[model samples]
Target: MSETSDSRAQRLAAESLAAGSPTAWFETLYDAAGRGAAEIPWDRGAPHPLLAEWLVQHAGEAAGADRTAVVPGTGPGHDAELLAALHFRTTAFDVSPTAIERVRAAHPDSAVDYRVADLFALPPQWRGAFDLVVEVMTVQSMPRTVRAAATAAIRSLVAPRGVLLVIGGVLPADPDPDYGPPWRLTHAEIEAFAADDLALEALDHGPDGLRYRAEFRRSRLLADTTSAIERTPC
Candidate 1:
């Protein structure tokens, strides 16, 4: 019997997870998307509500103009485009070259810079480079062990006094290992970003209770404190 699409995706996800390279399936999915074979479930064709709201609330702020923003794992670039619409210097990257190509093809005149980049191996200059960093549904797609690294990478993109916004699916306090692809993050995992000078400003669950949006801020004082502690010698 032929396998169904859902089953195929599940099998592929399991295989990728077991191989400890969950992002490998993203290339397959993007290739399929390019061929019009599979739809990317999270490509909403518009910015997510949390992102939209953030833009609305912050766009009028004094420093909003000329702000640098990045969207890591930007699959199709809707959120990146939204940032550009607000006049941010936006850079959007995806691990899949095909996905980056599709987004560029879809929006030829877009101001957002769309490129292929692995989160774990981003350019050295990208460290602490953005005034705003948005990660949507990217980290949860990876295997559990990789989530910490991914989260740290996401955290590293925020410059001092900048902000990080995260939107992803979340598990209940107690979660089952087998429940994934949209792997569910635990509260502890979400809170972990607060380490190393970043501060968790807000964490809110979606109305459906299956997803969450977290905001982290990098403050100058916190960065200085961390630097002082590091200099003090353990």
Candidate 2:
């Protein structure tokens, strides 16, 4: 009998964990999916509901006619497609080459630029270039030790006055030890994302207390001040 997709994913996840790479499984899974040997469990085939609602609420305001959005860990580009629909010049990137190809193939006419890139080593020009950065379940999928770096990297993608929307599993008040390939995030972990330049706007949990949605906004005032400082005479 042939090994099933779920089983393959499980095996890959185990290998990733054992290797301590934390992100290796992403490429492995995508490679399997590309070969029609495995299925991507999180490929919902549409933009996440939270993302859709966010776009509608800030339709004309936050996501104006000419803005840029980046979707990291863009599995099949569903969320990226939605952002493009709202007129944002969207860039969707995945660490897996095959994932990028799959999304591009799926949306042949899409204006969204799909690329293969790693979150940790993102193109320098992309730093603070996006008006909106959407990260859905990507950080939690990484190993615990690298989660902070991943969060910081995600934050770096947001430009001045930009918004970051994160959706992921949250660790329960009473945590479980055997918890994850989808590692659960804690309240402190989420709150720590806010800093001198970033501010937390909201943090809400799903009805069942299994998942959370966090919103952060970069300080436009700070950005402007920094720009002025850079332009000032020595």
Candidate 3:
């Protein structure tokens, strides 16, 4: 029996994770998708509704020419384009070269700076650099083994007084490693985003408490230099 495209993604992610290369399957997935053998399942073709609502709700706070935003693991850039529309100097990055390439191709006239970047090995200048970080559905897609580090990396992207919004599936119980390329996150895992200088300002649960939209804000009182980077793995 031939594996479906979705199943192929799961298999690729599983194999890469087992081999201790948690993010390597991203390139493989995009490469296959680029070759017309697969689909980017997470690409919603528009900004996520929850994110769109959040932006609308915070229009006063989010709209500004001086503001900067970044969407790490930005798959097809719907969210990035939305942010760019709001006058932010937005940057959307993905670890997969193929994914970035396709995004650039899809939006040749886009104002967004779509580039290739690894969350684990981000440029030093990017730390605490953005005025806003919209991290929807990115961290939860990673395995729990690296979930903490990934959360920290996302948290680190926000500038002092900035916001980090995380949207993802909520794990009702203990995370099962064998279940997903997009492994769901526990309450504790979600709380991890509030670590260090950030505080949980808002949390909204979706139907059956299976989805969540969490907002975290970093303290403006903190200096640019970080006291701790929270490099620990999940």
Q: Against the true structure, whose lDDT is highest?
A: 3
lDDT of 2 at 143: 66
Which is the leading candidate under TM-score?
3
Candidate 1 lDDT by residue in tens digits, 108-156: 9999989899988999999999999998888888777788999899999
Q: Which ten residues in a row have the lowest lDDT in candidate 3?
A: 225-234
Model 1: lowest-lDDT 10 consecutive positions: 225-234
Model 3 clash pairs?
none
* Candidate 3, position 228, lDDT: 23
Error of 3 at 231 (Å): 31
Shift of residue 205 alpha carbon in model 1, Å = 2.4
Task: Give the per-residue Cα lDDT of candidate 2 at 156.
Answer: 93
Residue 109's lDDT in candidate 3: 98
Task: List the candidate 3 regions with Cα displacement exceeding 4 Å.
Answer: 173-175, 220-234
In candidate 1, position 119 carries an lDDT of 89
Query: In candidate 2, what are the lDDT values of residues 40-94, reduced to their tens digit?
Result: 9788888887777667766575454689999999998999998898888999999
> Candidates ranked by lDDT, best first?
3, 2, 1
Candidate 1 stretches greater than 4 Å from native? 1-8, 61-63, 220-234
For all predicted structures, in order, the TM-scores are 0.87, 0.87, 0.90
